[model samples]
Structure formats: structure tokens, C-alpha cells
Target: MRLTVTFFTSMLSKVVNQINISADLNCGFELACQWRNNTAGEDSGDFLITSNVRVANHFNIIPSRNNSDELFAYTHGPFDGMQKATLISNTISCQLGGGTLTFWYYRTGDSATLEVCVRQPPGSLNTADLRCFPVFPKNYAHQWLFNAVEFPPLTQPFEVVFLV
Candidate 1:
């Protein structure tokens, strides 16, 4: 019932149990990742990463993003496939060290903002300035765009998020 973490000897890995995205998410975009926890054992329950978001004939489908997929998705106007403030997050505990996040994204229109941020329990002094991918504008009407985000560090619990 008690958990202790030490940096010098042990490295604690966060457990991402589930990935939930809005139903209106575009087909061109999808999220995938691998998650595991000693407690979960990586056997029972959903622990592996998978892509469930879609936008109807807009994305390349294969399996993993790094694998030999079709290549990329077709160009589109914007992320109208999703709700105005669609949110994407995972069911994981973030009360410890923050880790580096890297992902692939593609945008084509203007004003369709893709935001990557962290949300913590109320009362934390963490400010808005300590955010990554605060706004990912539609860079080009081309293939998927690679992005990397580095967080300073996290002390308390927080949830990483992606908003469109």
C-alpha cells in the first residue's frame, strides 16, 4: 500500500492505462503508445498503446506509427472532425518525475490550434508558462510533422494533455 521511489538506484516508470480521445477526432490523426506498470504486470487489462482516433479517409493505417505504414494522410482544411475544444489524455498517475514527450502531428489550416499541456490537481503553484507545445499551428499542407517536447520536471501529480 506504500510506494517509494529513488533516483540513484531505481527508475520509476509511469503507467499509462488508457488513452481517451473525443469522438469527433479527425481520421487523419491518431495517437499510439506503449504503457506498462509493475503492478499491472503488462498482461491483464489494456496496457499497450493503440490508435483509435480517425477522420474518414484522411490517415495512413497500418498499426504502429514507426512501422511500415501507408506513409501519411491526405491533406485537409482543419480539425473540424473533432469538437471545438477536443481533449486527449491518458489514464495515468503523474505525481512524479516528468519525462520527455515526442510525437508526430500534421496540420494544414490556419487557427486550428494543437495544444500540449499538463494539468495538475487544484492548488498546485505550477503556472501556465511551464507548458509544452502550447500551440502547434498548422505548419504545412504536407506529411506528418515530427515534434519533441521537453519538460523541466514534475514534483506533484499531473496529467499530460493534447487539445485541439
Candidate 2:
């Protein structure tokens, strides 16, 4: 069957059908995908605004810098109690619009929070840059869960970054 693509009248009202993230990401970060076109009686079929990128974390739980003293750091959590970390993203060359960053994390802490950020000019190398945080002090279950954030208008390439 041929699929006919029609322009969506209301961009904000487009319902997202499914949002998914990968747990065992080789890049050490989770990704989110949202199916918004399905809500408008169209099967966009994995039309993602954001691509698989990086996530950021809190400095207290996870060190902001790596052992090499690099700004993009990655440190394992402590074994005794809950641990948290934030992942930073590289330059996201978006091919489509309305890409969502989906994050998958293990709920180590009873009340842990993960943050995902996206900058207007990706890879600004400035913590004080423009960012969008999906969850602030988000409460997670004791199991591996998937969380997603959505965007609209798959128009241009956008940078995808995150904080936790």
C-alpha cells in the first residue's frame, strides 16, 4: 500500500505513539525515539527528531571531569549506595526534525534524578548554555526503565545533549 504524507495542521497536538530507549548503548548513553506521526493518522515509522547522542549528569554523584581531566567524563558509580552521573553530548547533526532524547537508566537511588539537555548551538562547551531539562529530581522505580522527551518539526539538524 502507498503511504500518503500530509502536513500536520497542529504541530503541538501531534500525539506521540511510542517512545523507546536503548539500555546497552555502546556509547554509554541511552537514546529516545518518539512516534508522533502515528498520532496524526500517519505512520512516520521511527521519524526521530533527535539522534542517538550523549547524556549529562550531576557533578556531586559523578565527577564532572574524567580521570584524564577531560570535560567529557565517565566514571562508574559507587558500589555501596546509589550513584548518579551526567553525560554530555557531541555535535548532533540532525537529519530530521522533532527528535527526542530517550534515556534508559538503572534506578540505583530511591530518589535519583537524571537530566537531558539540548543546546541551540550544539557543543558550545559552556555549561551555562541554553538547555532543556526533561526531569528534575525524577523518581524512578527499582528496575531498568525507559524515559523519553519529545520535540517537533523535523526540519533541520539539531544538537542532542543531556544532563543527569
Candidate 3:
């Protein structure tokens, strides 16, 4: 007996915007941000540049210890436990291999964390959903370092986010 062969066709639907967080905070980074502070004097916003990364600005040199010519940092003043920087990204279509959410960080406060997380489409993630890899815990190093977390495979679209 001979075997028969069959073939099926599938069409690609939505397109995914591959995002890489540029040092300028525009790597497809959406600023649906919010913060709670003890006073209104705090200046907290989306991801900002810092001149403390152990790594150089390999992309375009926004701001770093080596290149302090440009001021790329967004701060919440010298306050703590009150000021927060939560960066939320726009939705991105998940692909076969998924993608990575990365950034260069330099820690300052002893009680601060660069919490990395992702959001499922439609609904966002809560603190319980945070499973940060490549964590850069609060350290006085103030040295630039890269944190890259890979997104697991997802059938639908999703967003990558983290708080500073």
C-alpha cells in the first residue's frame, strides 16, 4: 500500500512590534505611568537615563558614567518609600521564540528594586505576577549593568514591563 500526503495552509494575522528599550526610554516604551508620593516635590516619571551603568551606551550613548555629556536621568528627588517609577510598555504580539525585556540599570537606594514583569493582553500584571530574572537588586554599585529577561511563548499578544 502507498501512503498519501496532505498539506495545510495558514495565514499570518496580527503583526508584532519588536521592542528594545533604547536608552532614551522610547524602545516602543509606552508611558502609562503612575506614582504615589508623600509630597508633590518628587519628580517621578517613566524610565530615564542614568550615568552609572557598568556597561557603556553601546547603542547610541544616551548617558553613562563614561559619557556624562547628556543628562538622561529621571528622578524622584531624594525621597524614598514614597516615590516610584513604574514603566509600562505597549502590547506586543508574542512569537515562537518570544522576546527579551532588557534595560541598563544602576541601583542607588538600599530598599529599591528594578522589578521586571510582563502583562497578558487585555489585563495587566499585579505585584504577584512579577517573576523578575536577571535581577539587579538595590545596590550602591551605581554601576551600569544590563538586565535581560526572556519572554516565554504566548499565543496572543502581551506587554513587558517593570518598575524602577
Pitting candidate 1 against candidate 2, the one with the higher TM-score is 1
> How much is the lDDT of residue 102 in candidate 2?
56
Better of 1 and 2 by lDDT: 1
Candidate 1 colliding pairs: 26-54, 26-55, 27-54, 27-55
Which candidate's lDDT is highest? Answer: 3
CA RMSD (A), model 2: 18.1
Residue range 1-164, candidate 3, lDDT tens digits: 11111001011112233433322223211221221111222225433433322222222323444534433333333335454555444455554676664555544444555555665652333445444553654444544566666777666655554545
Per-residue lDDT tens digits for candidate 1, residues 42-130, read 11212122232243455432323454432222222334544223222444344354456665654434455556666564223344632
Give the least accurate 10-residue stretch of model 3, judged by summed lDDT: 2-11
Output the lDDT of residue 68, model 2.
Answer: 28
* Per-model TM values vs. the true structure: 0.45, 0.41, 0.53
Error of 3 at 149 (Å): 1.6
Model 1 lDDT-worst window of ten? 1-10
Q: Model 3 off-target regions past 4 Å?
A: 1-62, 65-73, 77-82, 122-134
